[model samples]
Target: MISAPMLDHIVYAVPDLERGVNDIERQVRVRPVSGGTHAGGLTHNALLSLGAGSYLEIIAPVPGSEAPTGALPFGLETLTEPRLVTWAVAVDDIERRIEAARLAGYDPGERMAGGRDLPDGSRLTWQLAVRAEPAGDGIVPFLIHWLSEPHPSGTAPEGCQFVALRAEHPKPESVLRVLRALAVELDVNEGAAPRLIATLETPSGRVELS
Candidate 1:
C-alpha cells in the first residue's frame, strides 16, 4: 500500500505576472489576486483558490529583481510562458518526510523558512523542503509546512477545483518511487518526456493546465 500526502498548493511559473493573470482570468473566468512578495524580493506571485485546501500560485521574477543564487524554482528566472512547474504538499512532520526521501535514495533537500506578506499587511510564514537538484523535471512536488497560518486557498480567488492531476515520464516506476517517498500520488503514464498535467473545473467549463 502507498501513502499519499494532502496537497497544499501548485505553482504556475510565468514570465510576466500581469500577463499571466490575464491568461488565467481568461481561462478560469476569475482573476488571481496579488499574493505578495518573497523574502528575497526576487519574485512575486498571484494566486487562485482551487478548492478548500489547495490553491494555484503563479510566480515570476520581480522584473529587475535579482534571485539570490541559482535560478528560481520551475525555471521562472527565464520563463517565457506560464508552466505548471511544480506543486507542494502540506505536512505535519517535515523532518520525517525528508528522512523518508533520503532512505528512498532521493535527497529532498533541506527544510528552509520563507514567507510572504498578504495585501492586508499580514504575513504568512512557513517552511518547506526544496530539492537539492532539479529532479523529475518539476513533476515531483516540494513539501511544505504552513505552521498555523491561514492557508492562502481560503481567501484566494475561488470558483475552481482540480479534476485531475497527473504526469508522464520515461520511467514511471522510478518516478512513482519518489512520489511514494513524498507520500503523494499522481497518475503516471509512460512517455518519452516528463510532463505534468492537471484538469480543472472553471466557469468557462473544464480547462487543462500543464
Candidate 2:
C-alpha cells in the first residue's frame, strides 16, 4: 500500500514572485528562503519552516517569461491566483511509493527532473511525479520526491512554525483520509467549511490562514 511519510509543504500560486514574496514576508514577519527558478521562466518559491520536518511554500510564475521550455509537466498552467494549488508529502522510497500509488488506482504520472536555485546562487535538483492537472476544488495533492537531498526545512530559517491547517469544502476528514491512506501524518478537523487554511508563526509575527 502507498504510505505518506510526512507533510512536505503547502503551495500558493501568485502572479508576481517579488510581490508575492514581499506580501508573504510582511504577513509572516519572516522572509522565505529562495527556492530558485523552475524549467520555464516561471521562477518561484518561498520556503517557510513549519517545524517538525514540514514547511510552507509560495509559488508563482515569473512575468514576461516564456511558457516553459518543454511541456507543462504538472497542470500548473491552470492554477488561479492566491489559490492553494499544490503540496507534497514525503516518502521513504519514491519508486516504491509510486508503484504503491499506481496500485491504489492513481495514474502516478511520469517522473520529471527539476531544479531550484538557492539564495546563495546554488541550485538543487530533484524528481517527482507531475500531476496532469491541478487538484480541482483542492481535492488532490501533488506527489513529490526530494531525490538525494535532505528536506529544506531542516535548514530553513529559524522561528518559523506551522501553526495550523484548515481545509474548505470536500470535508477535511475526507482529505485527511486520503493523506492518512498515503501514510502521511496530518491532524485534520471536520464539521467546518471547505477551505484549506494554514497558520504560520514567524520571527516577526504570526501569519494566519493566508
Candidate 3:
C-alpha cells in the first residue's frame, strides 16, 4: 500500500458543482455536504470524508456567477470533465516547512491565506503554499496548515475510506527527487503523463479516482 501519513486532502475539480456531487454519490453511495463558497465568490465546493484527517473537495465555479478575468483556481475554466487536479499535505509550521523545502533545492511556493464559511455560519481558515512550479502537474502536493479547530474531514459526509495514493509520471526519477525534497513518499511509476491516482473504499465497493 502507498504510505501517505501527511495526506490532508485531494482536490477534484469539476465543471459543475452539483453534478459532480451527484455523480460521486451514485458511485460511492454517500452524498457529500455543501462546504460553502470560497473567498472571492468565484467558486464553491462540496466535501466527503476520506478517513480521519483527509477528505475530498469537489470544487467548481459558482452557478450563474461571473467568471473571473483570469483562469479560475485549479484551471476550472477549461475543464470539460471532473478530474483530480492536485492534493495537499498538512503541515504543523508552514513557514518552517517552506524553508526546509527551499533549502533542499525546491520551492513549494509562498504562503497564502485562504478561508471559506461553512454552511453552519461558522468559518474555516487556513494557509497554503501555492507553487508556481508544475511539480509534476499535481503529483507533487502543496503544503497546507489549517488554523481552524475541527478539521473539515470531521464534519464532512462519511462512508468512504482513503486506501492509498500514488503517482504516475513520465520522469519518475525527477518527481521522486521533488517528493524527497517535500519530505513525503508516494509510489511512483513510469507513465505517458503525470497523474495522481487515489484509491478509496466506498460503500459500494473499491473505487479509483485519478
Candidate 4:
C-alpha cells in the first residue's frame, strides 16, 4: 500500500450554485459563504468550514459561462446532481510530489495555475496538479499547492467538523491503492457503485453528504 495524502477539502458539484447553497443550508443548518469563481470562469463555489483544517466547497458552473476548449476540472459541466464529485489534498512541494507520483506509475498531470476573485475584490491564486482523468468519477483526488497564501478553509463560516469521510466501491482494494498513492486514506466499503460519503458534525447535529 502506498501513502495517501491529507485531506484538504471536498468538492460538491451542482448545476446551480444558489440551489445548492439552499440545499446544504436546509440540511446542514449552515449557509455556505461565497468563495468566488474559478479562473476558467466555468465554475464558482461557496465554502463551509469543517473544522480541523478542512472545509467543503459547493461548486457550480456559472450560468452562461463559456469554457471555449478543453475539459473543465471536477466534471462540473456534467454534474446533474449536487454530489461529491471530487476532492483535493495539499502537497508541501508539488513538483517534487509529481515526480514521485510519476515514478510510482501515476501521472497526475502537469502543474497548472489559476485563481478566483473574492467578493472583497481580492484574488486567491493557487496552482494545482489535476489528473487528466479523475478516475471513478472523481473518487480519486487531484493535488493542490497553495502559493504562500492563507488557505480559505481557516476563514470560512465555522460550525462544523468532519466526523468521517468514507468511500464505497465494488473494487475497494484497487481504489484504496490509488488513494494511498496520493497519501489519502478513506474508509472503503464494498458497494455496486463508487461514491464518497462525508459526515460532518454541525449545530443541527450531523449532516451526511455523498
- lDDT of every predicted structure (CA atoms): 0.83, 0.62, 0.88, 0.80
- Model 1 misplaced regions, further than 4 Å: 1-5, 68-70
Q: For residues 65-113, what per-residue lDDT tens digits would candidate 4 score against the true structure?
A: 8677744667776768888987788887999988887776666789999
| Better lDDT candidate (1, 4) | 1
TM-score of 4: 0.92
Which ten contiguous residues of candidate 2 have the minimum total lDDT? 68-77
For model 1, residues 27-131, the per-residue Cα lDDT tens digits are 999999999988477788999988858888988888887766767756777777778888788888989999988987888889999799777888899998987
The collision pairs in model 4 are: 3-183, 4-183, 4-184, 5-182, 5-183, 5-184
For model 4, the local distance difference test gives 0.80
Cα deviation of 158, candidate 4, in Å: 0.6
lDDT of each residue in 87-167, candidate 3, tens digit only: 999999999999998999899999999999778888899999987555888888889999987898998988999999988
lDDT of each residue in 1-210, candidate 2, tens digit only: 112234677777676667777887787777777776766546567776778878777776655655735333233555456665556766556777767767665555577776787767766777776466533344456567786565777766657777665555536665655554454444555544445566767776776653
lDDT for model 1, on a 0 to 1 scale?
Answer: 0.83
User: Rank order by TM-score, top first?
Assistant: 3, 1, 4, 2
Best by TM-score: 3
